[model samples]
Target: MTILSNNSQVTYSGTGRRKKSIARVKLTPGSGKLIINGLPGETYLQFSPNYLRISYSPLHILGLSNEYDIYIKTEGGGLTGQANAIRLGIARALCTINPENRTALKSEGFLTRDGRVKERKKYGLRKARKAPQYSKR
Candidate 1:
């Protein structure tokens, strides 16, 4: 995470990854507004409440949902992965804002980086671990 100050306004930034998705998030003091990839977050997320909820979970936990504007640039994987990545990024940025926030975020598991990813498909396998059918002659 990094912190940038411009004209007395502080901006906190963080990077997060989930599965194949990556999200770069910035937090600045402003009314609640979420922007993703230059588009309104709701539009980019297809207006899915679940996705919105996941992305905003950390802020809600800290009771600062409307205290900062979230700007995100995300790519890869799918909506689920991207949302999760955003969540982590937001959590990290919030921590930078205040060290005390870390304990709360960590207890809720927001600080945890999800390491699960798709397994590689083996050469002779139909899928990651699926095998072709065998039959007796």
Candidate 2:
């Protein structure tokens, strides 16, 4: 986590990863607004309520959704992965803002980094584990 001060306003930042996605998030005191990669969060996420909801769940959980602005730069994954990464990043930044927020975030499982990822495909198999069709005929 890092802190940046611009015009005397403090910004809290955090990085989060999920699968192949990485999200760098900044939290600043402002009306609730979400911006991702220079675009409105909803527009960038294709207006999918699910994605928006997932990305903002941490703040909503703490009843702080309207207290901060979320700015994020995310890349390298599908929407689901990116949304999750953003959620984790937001949770982490909130923790930095207030150490006391950690317990609440953790209890809600927002602080946990999901470790599941795509399994590597084997040399002679389809996908990660599907085998070729039998040749008994």
Candidate 3:
């Protein structure tokens, strides 16, 4: 089931994607705790400052960093992709809580989806754009 449809009066939810990663985020009233895949955010994201910053960008941008709890369930892709996906999901969930935030979030580009993905390799290519080696002999 999608996160948006699963939201209740007390919870706001959003779904986000980046590369091969997908994140479902839920926002609820509580201490400013963050959970990812059933683990604490700090533990799941490790000590990477970049991951923490990227994952919490949306909340920080809106000055709501310590207002609510963040719960994320993500799969696919690497750490960076998962972080960005969670950021987008949180931004969307915030918009659900207060539609007025939509303008600010959209203006900040958090509402825009990243469509970039790896291209498939061609039949005769080593990679998406890499050509096979030439043998002049």
Candidate 4:
């Protein structure tokens, strides 16, 4: 059976996390161009090109891509974090857009959110799990 039925269209959602920050993204199909919260990133360059390399959505969103279209809204993260989140969100949304993509996306590990974070410092130590230097007097 196909992952997505013919002409299937669904909303895509995903959460992105990066070093002490988190982001959420929502994606939807549009007319041959990406539109993000009504803002055109092409003129403003709201995000770095490294992040934009993820897909044609943002490029189209910024009116830079020749084909493919999407709209995205992201919140709760730094620039890099937001980009990653948006990437994952877009990947997931792609699955929603066409379930046939889910397997490939999942295999590429694009659907998983990075959950690593700084560990809490210990009360009696100089840092997390680090003990004070001892000097015998």
Best by TM-score: 2
Task: State the displacement of the C-alpha of residue 64, model 2, in Å, after optimal TM-score superposition.
Answer: 0.6
Candidate 2 — which pairs collide? Answer: none
Give per-residue CA lDDT, model 3, range 1-137, as digits (tens): 22333444377789999999999998887778999999999899987899999988888888998888988899999998999999899999999888899998999899998999999988988899999788999
Q: Runs in model 1 with CA error above 4 Å?
A: 5-8
Q: Write the per-residue lDDT of candidate 2 for residues 49-137, one digit (tens) a residue.
A: 99999999999889998999999999998999999999999999999999999999999999999999999999899889999998997
Better of 1 and 4 by TM-score: 1
**Candidate 2 lDDT trough over 10 residues, lowest sum:** 1-10
For candidate 3, report its TM-score: 0.91
Q: Score candidate 4 by lDDT.
A: 0.57
1-137 in candidate 4: lDDT tens per residue?
11232467544565556665454544434455555556664432365676566534433333434534555565554566666666666666566556677676777777777776679998999899999889999
Model 4, position 78: C-alpha lDDT score:
58
TM-score of each: 0.95, 0.96, 0.91, 0.60
Indicate the worst ten consecutive residues by lDDT in candidate 1.
1-10
**Over the stretch 5-89, how does candidate 1's per-residue lDDT look in tens digits?**
7667778998889999999999999999999999999999999999999999999999998999999999999999999999999
Candidates sorted on lDDT, descending? 1, 2, 3, 4
lDDT of 2 at 36: 98
